[model samples]
Target: MTTFITNFLEVFYVLIGLIMLFAGIESFRDQENPARIGTGLFWVILAVIFAGAKFLPYLVIGILILILGLLSLFKQIKPGNIKGIDEKVAEKSAQRLGGWIFMPSVVLAILSIVIAQFTPLGGQIGIGISSVVALITAAVMTHANANTTYHDSERMVRSMGTAGILPQLLAMLGAVFTASGVGELTAKAISGVFPVGNHLLGVALYCIAMAVFTMIMGNGFAAFAVITAGIGIPFVVAQGGAPVVVAALGMTSGYCGTLMTPMAANFNSLPVALMEMKDNLGVIKQQAPVATVLLVIQIGLMYVLAF
Candidate 1:
């Protein structure tokens, strides 16, 4: 049963790869494509890396990553139009369904909670399993509207484009950092500068580092594993502090960084485009003051309670 649950999570990645592959194929045939071959090749390459990463050797995956970097460097990936649903039809459907349009999303969250609590899959795999559950529920909710479901699915894949798999890619990169002894090297380097015995300074540095790195990486989650190993555990937790308080506040510090950076494209940039905002930095500007205040409060809290 445990093995089966884990395998079910692995299948989620395969499903994502299949969706990317299908989206890449669709891009190749798009009459309105601006970059044609470049666009198709970009997503197809991502599909290959994502689908085959599990089976491929690390050296080969590294090479694929290099190729992907070069493709991006050349500006190969371009945005496509959103072939959105008709507004009147969407409104009518929403009116027909009322608040139930939100039911599947709520169920998705509930399934994640249930799977994590009751199964051996743990939280990470539980999230993957929840995605699978969400997909199944969506199919059932849509009933026999096969054509619309498929068309809309493909459009969403295309709309998100190469960025669709970014969170997955970032999580895998975080795992790679953890496995490659990066944390140890970082810990040693930082300890030299901060000095380990200065509890207040060490705690301050750890929180600051979490925020800075998370801003750079665009994900607090991806940043958390690496930062916790490199600094939080080494600097804060080792000093007879409350581990729970340190971790909770440390992650919140990272979220402050997420609010401030354009690197967090899904959060900062996507909204601007989706809302047709006049300024690209409008969202960041609004978030900056809030993020700064929160970071200050979190740092203060981490220092106060952690001691």
Candidate 2:
């Protein structure tokens, strides 16, 4: 009975996620609501995360992404606001004549894959290499399509500047701490107090912890790395529940955090910047109630289902 209930909830979550994904994409066809485009991207990312960990019990995310991409290519989804096209031609010409500017990174990525295939660095190294390649590819695509000048890139980078880099740096720092075994020690210390038997309490605490950390850290990726190190994998799994549930619920809680923090400059600050708002915190303040309510609901759901 317990197994059947768990499977049913998992299926329900994935189906709802799929519906949201489709709805968000369909909303994009209405150009007046550029917000829908952003919302669609957010749902798609969430779906990917849910599906990636098998928490939702299916691989629907990849299919959703493909469908969204196809809709985009076919112009079913209206393209919102193309800025600065007048100067784009000049920029592209300069880039085309710039002589293999992106070759070095591309070469390193290919070389890394080759070495990984033949050497002992293994799957991890291969994945790392591929990720670097993918990042470079994405950057190239962005640059090519935007026809952005080096100056424009610099300006955009400088606008967010240090704020943009902080999350990635913190995440890397978290990884280093985990690698040094500090996470293991921390997990053990936390486990000593919590004791890991009550699955309901464990899931609730995990969701709460993830929300708080994400609020502080601003990026859920960093929060996930740190919290999972401290409580998630150890406490939740030891309670005989699935790690997938813990990770999914924890990440959703992090999104709730994203709604309240100025640290999530992409979500919070970008809108302010684009709108030229006098106060950076305006977006955060406006979104706080919604975030809080969602966080509460997510916690309750995690407790009921994950446990």
**What are the C-alpha RMSDs, in order, of all predicted structures?**
3.9, 19.5
In the range 102-162, model 2's lDDT, one tens digit per residue, is 5646666776677568966554455555554654665574465443433344333323323
Give the number of the best model, judged by lDDT: 1
Candidate 1 residue lDDT tens string, 1-307: 7787656656776776777777777778776867767777777877787677778898987787777767677887775655677899778877877888787788889888887899777777778877767877877765637677667666788888666656666667767777998877888898777788778887888888889999998889878878888899878898877999988999999999999999999899999999999999899999999999999888888889999
TM-score of each: 0.78, 0.46
Error of 1 at 90 (Å): 0.4
The reply for model 1, stretches above 4 Å from the true place, is 1-5, 53-55, 171-181, 198-200, 212-229, 237-248, 258-289, 300-307
In terms of TM-score, the best-performing candidate is 1
Residue 182 lDDT in candidate 1: 81
Model 2 stretches astray by more than 4 angstroms: 1-175, 278-280
